[model samples]
Target: IVLQNCMDTNEPDSDGLTPLMHAAAGGHEEVVGLLLSHGARLGDRDNRRRSVLHWAVLTYREAVLRLLLKHAATDDPLLIDAYDESGCSPLHAAIDSGFEIGVSILMEFGVNI
Candidate 1:
């Protein structure tokens, strides 16, 4: 229905979270891919100014994080270092969340500590 209706993929909810943010938070890689293919903005921030990469790392969504990184690699390459309102970068969020794999992935993508 979303695809057929051509729904606004970048539309945020009351919390300022778009479908991409929710999908990344839930570790829904396929949904993230679908949304991205439909032009979902990877840099969209939530109410807290947390990007989809931040949400993916905070939630320990390894697959979603990878997918996001893959797209971001060619597009907005700086997204890996994006900071939220709290000044927490995706790398910071991943480390603080104790997600080793997520941290490793972020580092591999050239995200500085």
Candidate 2:
């Protein structure tokens, strides 16, 4: 299914899930590819200021995370400087969720602890 352009880049949906967030949270590699091809904004944040990486790490969605990293023009954005409303980032989320795979993925993408 073709996701609408607005829908692809739109902010978080119900339950604070963006297309990028959903793709990352669910480990949907194809969906993540479609979203990126549709020019979805990688840095788009949810209501909590959590980017795709945040949800990816939170849910340990490894497949989606790797796809996103591959398609991303930036190896690592200024995500290190970004924080959620509660002053947390994807790294923090991974640590909190105890997702070792997620943490490693984030680190591989050049995100510092």
Predicted structure with the largest TM-score when compared to the true one: 1
Which runs of model 2 end up more than 4 angstroms from their true locations?
2-8, 14-16, 73-76
Name the TM-score of candidate 2.
Answer: 0.80
Q: Could you tell me every candidate's TM-score relative to the true structure? A: 0.96, 0.80
1-113 per-residue lDDT for model 2 (tens digits) = 44743553555676676777777788888777777777777777777788787777777788876777665537446754468889998788888889888778778877766
Report the Cα lDDT for candidate 1: 0.91
Best by lDDT: 1
C-alpha lDDT values of all predictions: 0.91, 0.73
**RMSD in angstroms between candidate 1 and the native structure over all alpha carbons:** 0.8
Model 1, residue 17: displacement in angstroms? 0.4
Q: How far is candidate 2 from the true structure (C-alpha RMSD, Å)?
A: 2.6
lDDT of 2 at 112: 62
Worst 10 residues of 1 by lDDT: 1-10
lDDT, residue 84, model 2: 88
